[model samples]
Every structure is written in C-alpha cells, then in structure tokens.
Target: MNFKPRFVALLVTLAVLVGAAGTYIGMQYFGDPGGQKQTANADQGAQNFGSLSEEEQKEFLDKVGNTDLKKVEQAYSVIKDNYVKDVDQQELVEGAIQGMLDKLDDPYSVYMDKDTMKQFNQTIESSFEGIGAEVSMVDDKVTVVAPIKGSPAEKAGIKPNDQILKVDGKSVEGMELYDAVLKIRGKKGSEVKLQIDRPGSEDLLTVNITRDDIPLETVYSDTKTVDGKKVGVLEITSFSEKTSDEFKKALTKLEDDGIEGLVIDVRGNPGGLLQDVEEILKQFIPKDKPIVQVEDRNGEKSRYFSELEKKKDYPITVLMDEGSASASEILASAMKEAGGYDLVGTKSFGKGTVQQAIPMGDGSTIKLTLFKWLTPDGNWIHKKGIQPTVKVKQPDYFYTNPVEIKVALKYDDTSDKVKNLQTMLEGLGYDPGRKDGYFDKETVDAVKAFQKDAGLEVTGEIDEKTGGKIEEKVVKEVRDDKNDLQMKKALDALFK
Candidate 1:
C-alpha cells in the first residue's frame, strides 16, 4: 500500500487505462497572436485545464513550428465556425486526447475524462457503489474478471471471462472501458441488465443484477472437527485495503479456538494490493524469509520478506482455482515455498506483473506496468500458472449440469460414466481405490457396500435404482449444501 509520492496511483486488478501528462491543457482562443485566454466554467477548476505557464508555453510553441500551430488554429476555427451545431470546447479537447490514446492499442492505457476519473478514484478507495464484480477489457470487449463472493453479481451468476455485450439493452461494443463500467454500474437497488456471452454456450444470456454497496468482509474463518481433530477453515473472498488486518484477526480467533490444522481457500479471488498479501504471508512465515521478488523494468530486483518472529507450526493447505490470481498466487507461492504448505485445487489464474498508478494534475490517472513478480524460488508464473501439490478439480456437477446416470454400472464397465460413479462412491465414504474409468472388483465391492448402507438390494452390480440413489447422495454431499469434496480431500490429506 506504500506509494511513491510522485507516482500516486493504486495497484488495481479492475483498473482501466487512463491517459495523462503532468499538467492541465486548456484550449486557446482561435486568433489571438499574443495568446488566447481559456474560458471554461470556473466550477470545473480541477476538471478543466488552463493555459500552460509562460515558460512551458514558449517551449511548446518553439517545439511545434509556427506553421503547425497555424494549421491547428485553422482546424479549430473550421470546427467552431463551419460545424452545424455549437461545439463544446471541453468535449473537443477530451475527444482529441482520447483519439491519441486509442492509437496506443493497449487496453490498460486509457483516457479518463473528468467524470470517469472521479469514479476511478472512488473505486480505488474501495467505497464505490455498484454490483461487486471486477472487470477488465479483454480482446476489445468488456469482460468480467471475477465476481465478488456473496455479492449481487455472483448471486446473479456473473462468472469470470463472461463477455458483456450490452448494458440496459444498449450495445457496448467498442465503447471505452470506463464508459461501459459506468453503464453497467448504477444506484443501489436499481437493476442493470447485462447481456453475457459465456464460453461453451452459443446463446447470449441475460443476467439482471440489482446493484448495491459491496459487502467488504474479505476474510472468513471457522473451526470444524475432522475425525475428532479441530481444523481451521480460512476463506479469503478477495484482497482489499483491510484484508491483511482481517486475516490476522481471523487467524487469532482460530488459534483461540485451538486448531490443529488449517485450510486456506482463495477459490474466486481476483486479487488486490500487493502489500496486503505480503502482510498475510508474514503471519505464517518466519522473520526475514523471502516471500516474493519483484523485478523492475531494468531487471533490478527487490525481495519482500516476512516480518514475523516465528513461523506457525500447524499444517496448512491452500485451495485455489482458475479465478485465484495476482496476490492470491503470490500468497499461494510464498506459503508453498517458505512455509511448506500443501496446495490443493486447480491451476491458478496467472497474472504476475505489477502496475503503478500515476496521478496527473488534471484529475486523471494512469496505471503503468512497473514490475514482474516471481515466486520465492525465482519461478515466473505469468501466463503459466502454478500447479497444485494435490490437483483436485472440483466436480462440474456440483455447480452445473447434473451428471447423467445412464445404464447400470458394474464390474468390468469401462467408461467415463463409471468413473463418475467411482469418484462419487469414494467421496461418499466407500473405498473405490481409484477413480479411473475402469470399474474393477474394488469398484464392485464399494458399490455393494453403498447398497447395503442405503438399505437397497445388496447386489454387486449398480442397477437403475442404484444409479439414482448414487446421484441423489452425490447431489446431497456435493451440491445440496455446497461443494466441499475438495475441502474433504484436504482434510483427509492433513488428518487421515
């Protein structure tokens, strides 16, 4: 969270590209040789620009020859006099600036008009009003980076990588990122209809989200008894300004409750401040231990360290998924390298670069890439994400379409359906040995054991009735409440 005074911009995952120089730039009157006076609304002092200081103005005029200056004046006069309607000087200036930035072709570099700049600052301060979802411009389209957990956006099923096609029935194609965000975000309790194009689906889905002030609880923890041993479950929804503080408090509460092990979940986290993550890692890592190394553009490296006096001794398991990115990956990598924690879940969303925001005097800001982050061991995971120590991909049926229970499955049946059955059986306490598609003798015995427990026909083969029962149990154990098979596996690895 420490920012250099000259570069007073925030590190943000959902930030838009803003274009800015060091000072205000107001337009001059068309035909004054001495220098035209700027006459914008006085109320927009910060938003409006005035003529440069005398020395700077002389320097600029000298740099651009008088011929080019005359040409610019002629163009301005043409637009002012020949245009059918009255032209707003501010709009013309802002438009010209936007055109220049568009040529950069970098989605992260943007031009923020006064209004957009206000919203951008509000968001950076973390007190904005809108549907809680992190968004970024990807492939010239407005895409959802990640929906905040338990927010209206997430509840409405706005998923990561969903292409937003329209807002309130208006096409947003080719619109500025800030403009698209402004259209999508609205007053609390007001509804904004988003046309989403999700991957794997041909049809465009309309998701209506009722905007609200996002809930700011970034950390949650509780203790659960697993095989008579107390295990702490610490789930971080996302990193925020106060995330490290919240994490410390959660860990203190868990310690007071006497936990024997820990499970850290960062499943849908998009990421936030780099300092917050470093502080969180400090709690479990020993003093002076390297957490991560940041290499600047010139290849000069700065290593961040843990400030803790002693490392925590309990076994820790980190849970991650495709949505976990940036600081989440930073914490995961540090914990694995320095604390020797076990990582369980799918590959992470790899985003390893660092950005620094530079605020301009004209109420605009620019976020520029400044560094590339690496793991404690110097491994770079930019486009290539970190693989988990124990790869446990969450079953799709837990949140999506139900697994089809087709023909009866028994010993010698070799198909993906049998694999699903075996995985479910193992999840429900039956020892199927392996989850490979082949239904061997071990699978048949596990099926018979499940039948006997469920009070069904105790046949070794899975019948139609048995398949339905298995599906029901799988739904109950995995879906009816929430997906916890990954968590169960983590606990099994830690305790049993």
Candidate 2:
C-alpha cells in the first residue's frame, strides 16, 4: 500500500502539506457542514444536458457550441443515446470529472464526493470518531500504513504494512482506500474486524478493533532523568490544527521541568497540517530563518520563515522511520538544517510535494498537488526519503509480531531479530548499548537486568520467558513513543 501522510489528506491514510500560498479554485459561499447537496453544481452542466429531450438537447448543444463546453455536451449526448441502461446523469458527470483527474496519475490529486470532503475536513480539524489508524492504497490493496499510538488498531496488534484482506469479513480486494476506510470507521464503541496480511508471514491474522473518539492532541511530552541529565521527550503523532498549541504546552512544561536536552519522535507519524508544523518550528528556529521552500509548476519559488525571536539552545534529536512523511519530513528537515539537530532511525517516507484542498462551490473538493517542497538546504527528498544522520532500523518482527520468539536468542547472536530485542530493552529503560543487530556485552547485560526485574533467572539469554517479558515492556512503551528504537537512540545519545 502507498504510504500516506497523516493529516493533509484522508483519515484512513492520506496526508497533504498545505503551507505555501494556495490558489483556491472553487469557493462555496454557504451550506450545511454535513449537507449532501454541497457538490451538486460541480457537474450540473453535463447533468442538465443529459436530462434534456432530443430537441432540447440539440438546442442546448447549439447554445454551448460557441464555448469549450460543447465538447463535454457532445460526449454526454453520445453516452445517453447509446448506453444500455438509464444512467445516473449526476454519476456520469462525476465520473467524467474523476476520469479527467485520474489521467494525471497523481496520487495526491483526487476528486472527493460530498461525504469524503466532509470527512477529510474533519480529519484536518483534528477530531474524529474512529478506530485510529493510517491506511492507504498500496499496490491497489487496502493496506495499513500505521496505527495511531494508543488507538484501538494499535492495541489490537495492527502493524505497519499489514494488508487488509477483509473488513468485517467482507473482502476488500481492489477497493479504493477512501471507500474502505469509510466502511471501517464508525461511531464510538462500534466494532470493526480486519483480516491482516503481514508481508513475511503466510498465515492471515484477524484483529477485532473497537472504534472511539480519536483526539486531536498531536504533541505529547514529559521530562525524564537520564544519566543524571534532565531530558525532555516530545512525541508528535501528527501535525493537525491543534498540534502547534499542544506542542507549545508540552515545550513550556518541559522547560519548567528544567530539561537540558530534547528528543522529538515522529515515527509512524503520517504527518498533519503544514501550517501547524511551521508554527511549531517557530519556537525552535530563529526569527527570519527559512523553514521550508516550495517551488510551483512555473518554477516560481516561495520560502516560509519562522517568526519567533526567542530560541531554545538545548541539544535536540529527532526520531523518524518509514512511516513518517510530509509535514513530519518538513519538521525533520528544517530542524536538522536550521537547528543542527541529528536525526536517528531509518529513512523517512519521502513525500516532498504540497497539496491544496480546494473546496468547490458545491460540497465536493479537489485536493491537488500544486508544488514541490525543498529542505532548508534546498534538498528535494521526494521518493528518496530523508536519511537519518544516525541510521537505525528496527527488526521486522518488531512491527509484524512483537511477541513469540521463534528461536532462542543468546549473547553473540546476530540478526535483525536481535536488534528488535535490543530496541525493546531500551524502551523498558534498559540500555542495550546500541541497536546494531549484533548481541554484544551491553545487550547481554541489559537482558539480564530485564530478567532480574521480571523475577526470572537473571539469564542474559533471550529465552521464551525473557522474550515474553520484553514484548510486554515494548507494548507498553510503544504508546508513549511511536518507535522504541529511535527513542532509545535519542536518549542514549543525550545521556551516554
């Protein structure tokens, strides 16, 4: 499935960066927020012609002959006369509009129906009632990009890259992402069953999740005493309308706690509002510093700048992974350039384009990619994601299956799975040295510490009991920080 940024797009995995000057195409004056007739006029011209009688059709055609609309009229008349069944004129018109945009082959560009438009707006506003998860159309399959931390999907063991084989026992093969999401999300306390396919495993996994009200609290932070140094960890889940305010509150509280360093975690963060990111960056970046640069189709360039003069001088690190994209990338790139922060974790999702959600006069909306963004250093990391200064990749099973170690992992063992154990250890407050995949002396020591704490035989080897304990620790810490490996590295770098 395609990796979608969390905020700028749809709720079930789509994100857009809305920063630079947006050219609004169609602005509707007034309508009910949840009204169905909001998109009625988008294709009304063709629909009106389709409803006319043979003589009236010709007259209408003649009336529009002097304009470019005659071409559309001719096509509609042909379809009306030759189609086997009586077609829904409005549907035909909407389909034509969608087809036109489809020809562009841009995933970010989409024609949203009234309901979709409403839902998309709700997501941007940062409040929704659903089973929190980011999903996207990956290879035409409904795939799970990442479950929101503390969300029902995450609690149900839904992992990144898990394909949706069925929803509520209904096969979702070849289903559009937006449509599938609509079916999956419902009122609070409602149940949604999903059949999952993790890439490396052959057996399908089923998860029954209960939907709830996913809050708009995008930023979370707390101070931790690491190696006698005051360290603040700020977790950014998604950049939403409320993200900037939340970030400020978290930062202020951390400052009050007298933190000397900071870590910003954006792992599995699909990204949110671009302006929200820009506003958050203002607190860190110096006034007048370039935050991000955007280039339009005509080669016109615009740079967004920070507005705050007061800046924090603490050493900072950012945590990221393949699930981070768009606004998250913007924040990571800008901070790395302007604030001299080091990024730890694997490369990001690499979405560098900007999209605008232009509301049509009716209820529908056309979300189109209007420009490409560049990092403060003028780097375009589209497709090729932003690589971390310190590259750390978690074990595959860390995402697919956190529990149930298939093999006995002892000291000197080397594999991606070992790295997974190390990551979990670090999250549970044990220092596993480094997430280097190789089981070194530090890893053994950390494992032994964990075993002793769990009332096990204090064995350095990761046996079944040891592995189960590690999984429990990891599951608990995951909601606190999006990615355990990245967060551990950030803390280690600051304290050690």
Candidate 3:
C-alpha cells in the first residue's frame, strides 16, 4: 500500500468518527437529534452541479448548517436551564419573536399577544364605549387638545388645553400615555373623575364624565367673508363621513353669494376617512389625476385619483398652521398640485404615514402604520412640515382691545374720572349713587336714567359725546381747583 493514500484514508475516517461521536453526545444531552431530519432530507434531494456549482454548495451548507435536531434541542435546553426566573415556555418563545419584531423600532409594527389581538379585532367591527376625548401627553402631562364634539368629554365641559392632574383620584404623573388613556376609557355609563388644571384659573377643577359612543363627523362649512372680499370660507376640520355633501352645500352657497374666492381653513385639523378627503378634493381637482399613492409592504402600490369634474371657479387660499395635519395636508397638497391655490400661515404638522385601525377579537383596536403617503408632487411630509406659500401671523393685540360693544355701563369708582363723572352727574341732577371706582348697577341705572331725561338716546353708553358733556360740567364745577393732577390725567386720557 502507498503510505500517502493510506494516511489520507485514515484521516477521512477519523473525521467521520469524530462527527458521529459529537452527534451522539448532542442526542444524549439534548432531545431528538433528528428533529430537523426532514429539512436535511429535502435539501439533500437537490442533484448535480457544474464543477461544484455555487447553488449546490449553498444547498449543502444550508442543509447541514443548523439542521441537526439534536443540537437545536440542546440549545433550547441550555436556555431553559440557565434562565434565572421561572418562565412560561410559550411566553419565552413569543417574547423572542416579539423581540425580533421590536428591532424594527416602528411604533406601528407590533406583536399583539392573545388578549391584545382579540381586543384589536373587536374594535374594528363595532363601536366601543370610551370617554369622548382625544387625549395625548404633552410635556409629561396628560393634555386635552380637543374634546370630540358632542362626546361625553365635551358634554362634561372638558375644553382644549386642559391639563389632567389625576384620573379617578390616581395621579397621572409618570404613567404611560396609553395606560392613562385606557384608564380613562371604559364601558358605556361608567363614570370617571378627572382633576384638571386650566390656564388663568387659580383652583384645580374636577369634572366627572361618563363614557359613551363617539361618532366622528368630518366636514363643516359656514359662509364668511375675509378682508371684505365676500369670499366663502370653508373650514374642513376633518375629512369624515358626510364631508362631500357638506362641501357641495358650501359650494352652492358660494355660487349663490357670487363669491369670487375661497379660503379653506384646515388649521388644527387631524385627518380622518381617506375617502372623504378624496371626495372633497374633487371640488378642486380635475378627474383622473393621481391624488395620492400608498406604498405598502411587499412592494405593492395603490394610487387614489380625483374623480372630480365640476371644478369650482375661484381663487383658492388654504389657511394652515402647525396644528393642521394628515388629511388636511393631503387636501392642501392636492389643491396645490391642481394649481392656483395659495397656502398661508405656519408650516403644517406633518404626519404622512397611513394607519389602519385593526380590530382585535376584544373590544379594542390597534392603529398600525401600514403604509406611507406621498403627495402628487412626490413630497414626503412625515416629520418635516408642509411650508406655506404666504405666511400670516395673528397680531398679539387683536383680542386685547374691545372689538365690539354689545352693552355699556357706568363707573362710580373712586378713580378721579369716576369721581368727577359722579359729581358732574349729581350737579346735573343725574345722581350716580356713590363716588367709588366700582361700576355698580346703581351707577349704570343712573346713567341710563340721565340719558333718558336729557332726551339723548338711552343707550347708556358713555361715548365721546356723553363724556364730553360730563367733562364740561365737571370742569365748570372744578375750575377753582386747577392744580388737581388726578383730574388733569383723567381729562387728558378721556380727551385723547
């Protein structure tokens, strides 16, 4: 025998012997060594390769790489033995799967456990009772941005910008947002007490509300003018059911008003009902134009188009702010793409992902992001906001001064003006009860009575004309006291 050939044969036999021993050891310690036998068998069924083809090698490697049932069983056994706490084997397995999914770090990608999955399914098919408020955590506090109109939250007098301090006597501090929401929401007729704090108030307010079914309505419109232009201002708060019908009515009113322009205010509106947005856009966009495209998993794509014909003839301006989001952005983008519309105010709050409310078997649902939306112009406004074409800021002092006078009253305060007015009214036989700075009912009554007696319009309004007469009377009476600073200041302010 050739020593080289003999030595090679011995080495090959030794390698096979070692593999056999290792397999036996794995089988003895672990469970079934043949657990993956079917997989290995199927992989080995592949035939011939061209000069040890890459495909053949891959198939071979895949078959033997992790196919040893014994080794896999041993690995699981090791984990069970080494795990520090008593673990539910099923839970461990599910947790592992969930952990893998969590690596995606997507808020939408979730593993619904048995109970959660059931709840999610149920929420989709039927209405579940809950407090009618869309609540969110802002700056670590539960804040109510808006109470769903006509919902229990609104009925209970919950207003936007209210900070919830406690829910049902439990402090909400450091609680998870969803957990807080769940606690607040319950079956119909269930009552929950909320401790809230509102701005410009000194005391914490408590409100008790009952859970109820909340139906979200989408489109709302009213005829109003902007800049004396007599334009129809359609405020589409959200694209919901009946939105298209509402839009049609608004359009008809605009036509009847001889409106030449339109201002669609989408400020502070969250999106709803994709179909409603599509239908509303029909009033502005031409039919057959692509409105939006949703690209989902598996590389599948779906496009929504405008089926609109009778386009409204008007100069369109969309008013938007940071609070305007979702369906609002869709409508705004569509109008922009259709051409001849101006976007005003601040950039929008960009939420460009599409979420589907998937109902579990239980009475809860999970809103998961199934796809992302892109504007017809190919703009992705997910985290980045939509920019306005013409930015208009509200003046800070707009509400500081009196815009209108619905009622008028007289002052009898100790302030020099009040004292002078009182003394003058008394001299004129229009006795204002006291010279106090307070504007009491007696003072108002006396002013009205004086207006009536003087044959002046009994509006009880202390306007420039009435004030002038009162000042003249006071000056004539007080001319001897010329050095009065208070009287001079009061007169200066009133005259100016």
Candidate 4:
C-alpha cells in the first residue's frame, strides 16, 4: 500500500495551532472588563462593518483592533482606489473571515462558508454522496491513494497508486485539496470523469465513475492454511462499526476449522472508531483486563476494560507495518502487553491522539483533538510507534527473477487467481519475472511456456473452470523437490 502521513497527525497539529490563535484573539478582545468605552468601540465597529463595501469590509475587519479608525479607513480607501477588477463584496468578506481562521493553521478548523460547510458535516456522519476515495497531493499531483473498500471508486476499478490528473474535464492544478474533494463529491447517481494514470501503464486511462453512498467496512476476514496448520487470517482493515462482529466471525471460523494458530494482518490499516477497537480487544483478553486508558483535560482518567470471559487458546501472531495506525496501535499494544501473542513485521504508524468530530449547526464538522490515548501500561505510542516482537522484512527474492521464460499460447491475464498462481509458480522452478504479484505479460508468457512443455494447451492462464489440469501436471514435476517441503507440510496438516 502507498504510505502517507496519517490524518490524525494533521488533525493534532491543526488543533494546537488553532487553539492558540483562539486564545490570542480572546485575550486581545476581552482583556479588559472594566472599560465601558470598549463596548462603545465594539458597537461602532459593528456599525462601520455594515456600511463598508466587501473588500473594504474585509480590510476594516482585519485591522479592527490592531490600528486606529483612521488607519482602517485608509486601508479600505487604498483597496477601493487601486482595484483592477470588480470583486464581489460578500465573497471578499467571506474570504477575509476564512483567512482569519486559516491563520490558526488548523487543517480541521476552518470557516467553510455555508455551501462547503454543509458538505463537511455530511462527511462526519459518514453519509457523503460521492465517489468514495481518499485523495491526497503526492508529487504536486492529485492521487487516489486508496478507494474505500467496497466503495463506488473500488467497485469502479480504482486502485491504489492511480494518479488522478483531471476531474470532470478540469485540470486539478492550482486547486486546493479541500476544493478538489468538494468537486469530486456530489449527489448520488451523478457521474464524474477521472483521468487516471495507473502504475506501469504507458498511457493515461480515463474512467467514468458514478457517485454513490459509501459506507465504510472496518473489518474483513478469511480463513487460509499455513504449513498445514489450519491458520486463520483476519484482516482488520480499519476500526469502524461491525469490526467486533467481523472479528467474532473470524474466531468462529478458526474454532470451526479447529486451527492451532492464527495470524491477524493489520498492515496498511489506518484506524477509525475507538469503541470498536475496545470491543475487539475483549475477544482476545480475559474479563476485567484493562485494555487502554484515556485522561481528559481535568486530569481524570477513564479506563476501558475487556469484557471477554475466556480467551482464545490458539497461538496468535499479528502482522503490522507503518500503515497500521491509531486504534490499530492500540490493539497491537494491548496484545503485546497482555502476552500470548507474537508481533511480526515493522513498527506501527503511531497516532495516539483521539479526535472528536464535532458537527457545526451547518453541514460541516470540526475534528478536534480531544485527548491523547495510552495503553493500559501507560506506554505512549504517539509519534514513536510500537516495536514488534519479531520484526521480519519481506524477502527481496519475491521480486527479482534470474531468468525469463516464453510461451507458445495466450491466457486470460485479468483473472483474480493470477496473483495466487504467480506465487505458486514462483514456489516451483519456473521464473516469471518480478512478483509485483500481477499476471502481466511476463507471467502469462512463462505460464504458456510451462504448459507447452507439460503437453497441455499452451494457454498461459489458469481458470477455475479448467483447474486440476495444470496443477496435476505442474505439481507432479516438483512434488518431491526440497523446495516443495512447505507445500507438503501445508497439505499434510489439512489432511490430518
């Protein structure tokens, strides 16, 4: 997955900067309560504010208390005298208001004028009507880092690493990130054109995507075997609603399969709901075990406890990387502190700040940093991420191939099973170029060449409809090789 800064990091920075600005402004305006003339000055300022033109009003508001009335008047006079183009007074006033808020430097806090503000509120409720994809600026261009799983963008074939150059035929150059988001999001059923550049493709790709309601799924799981141990792999993609439920199902599958161990893959997962994470903890922890604690502004600490009565007995290993953030770190920390689990992979993307999405009366919302969270043992995994118990880097041999193979036939390159087949192929003797894990032309050629040598149809593709044909031939060739030891172990465990 593409790595980027976590959203929570930006939120915390914005909150601190904006809060300081608010404090400063409060001190300046309400510093002296004893001066009756202050009231008179405020009323006079309000009156003058109503009389000025848009640009003049903005200039007046900005210099209101900093300078005397004469200076304010002079500033407005200059703007009116030297203006080159006609400007809307209301827009100018709004822009000045926004400028003041922007000075706070909080990405989450801003004056969203009535229109944009409404859409902001919808995002917090998670009920936005638009193409569901998280976008950001990378290398000065708008890029789709990841389409929310099962969202319209994902359903429309948008993938991570796709560069979005244009939206609705308009270039995204010079457009603010917020503005670009607003333009891409719209009422449901509406259509938007995205000019995308996919990785390894030479030309730009155009995709017409329709907007739809995007409901986030925080948890997803599937059962698989590793070394014949009936290992269950549950991927908690994010911490959102239904996460605990999904986790329960994963545990149920393990129980049904009578698996001896499990692996939870949390790589590339940016966090969401905190309550969901706490609930998930209950499954692995015993009742009354402390999961985490949060201390609020008044120095009061709230402890979250696990409600699980009995813990799963299977040995568990957690897979994490830099993309595992926030609530993900919370869960990983708890599992490590509680013991019985081994963490494998890189350090987590640390983001311990908790943000409250406070909705304005209008449609917009403010994600305010409420409190910083800590593990039950009081370990602060904020900027410094959690260290894994067994850190293992992905093997480089998975990428580089020593030789290239040619084929006598063509195969379906778009089948979903191609990736798994490529992995299986690499496990055998046939070299299929780099395993970026796609059945590209190289993989297809290798497969066709293998098929021709095995006295099978020269098609390079493996289809479920035609399976067991290639597997029977391919598996027989290297069935007794030392390299096939892992596959034998997996098959033996399944049979046993």
lDDT of 1 by residue, 1-496 (tens): 1223231221110111111210000100011001111222422122211244566435444544456545545766677678999998666656655554576665544555566556544554455567877766778888766777767787666676788899989999988777777687777899998888877544476777888777667898877777898999989976666888999988998998889999999887877677778888888877666898998766778998866887677778899887787788998998888878888888987777765444444565444445689999888897687888989977654433123444676778887667767777877789888877799988889989999999999988887788778767875765333466678778777754
Estimated TM-score for each candidate: 0.69, 0.71, 0.50, 0.53
Stretches of candidate 3 off by over 4 Å are 1-104, 108-131, 135-166, 169-178, 186-215, 226-230, 245-259, 287-289, 296-303, 309-311, 357-367, 393-496
Q: Score candidate 4 by lDDT.
A: 0.54
Q: Candidate 4's residue-wise lDDT over 1-496, tens digit each? A: 0111122222222322222000000011000100011111221211322344686545433533334434434644455456797665544544444454456444323344455544443443354567766554445566553455556775555654467778889887766456666667677888998888766544466677888776545556656665656666677765555667778877787678787776676765656567777777887877555788785655567877876777677677777766566677888888888644667777876566664443332333333445668887887787688988776544322222111123222243443244445654665556777455566778877777667766776667654322344444344443333433322232233233
Candidate with better lDDT, 2 vs 3: 2
TM-score of 4: 0.53
Q: Pick the candidate with the highest TM-score.
A: 2
RMSD, every candidate, angstroms: 11.0, 9.9, 20.4, 13.1
Off by over 4 Å in 1: 1-87, 92-105, 121-128, 287-289, 399-482
After aligning candidate 1 to the native by TM-score, how far in Å is the CA of 36 from where it should be? Answer: 40
| Candidate 4 collision pairs | 14-106, 54-89, 117-364, 118-363, 121-363, 121-364, 228-490
Tens digits of per-residue lDDT for model 3 on 1-496?
1122122222222222222000000001000100011111221212222334685445434544434434444645666678788766655544443444345444333334455435433442334467755444456677664454446775565654578889899998876444566677778888999898876344476777887775444445555444555566677654545666878787787779787666777765545556667777766887656787676665466777766675666666777766566677887787776654667766876667665433222232223355677787777787687887766543221101111112333443334344445555765567677755455667677778877766677755565566655544544443333433322222222112
C-alpha RMSD between model 2 and the true structure: 9.9
What are the clashing pairs of model 2? 1-138, 2-138, 5-15, 6-270, 8-16, 13-135, 38-362, 38-363, 39-363, 239-273
Question: Global CA lDDT of candidate 3, please?
Answer: 0.53
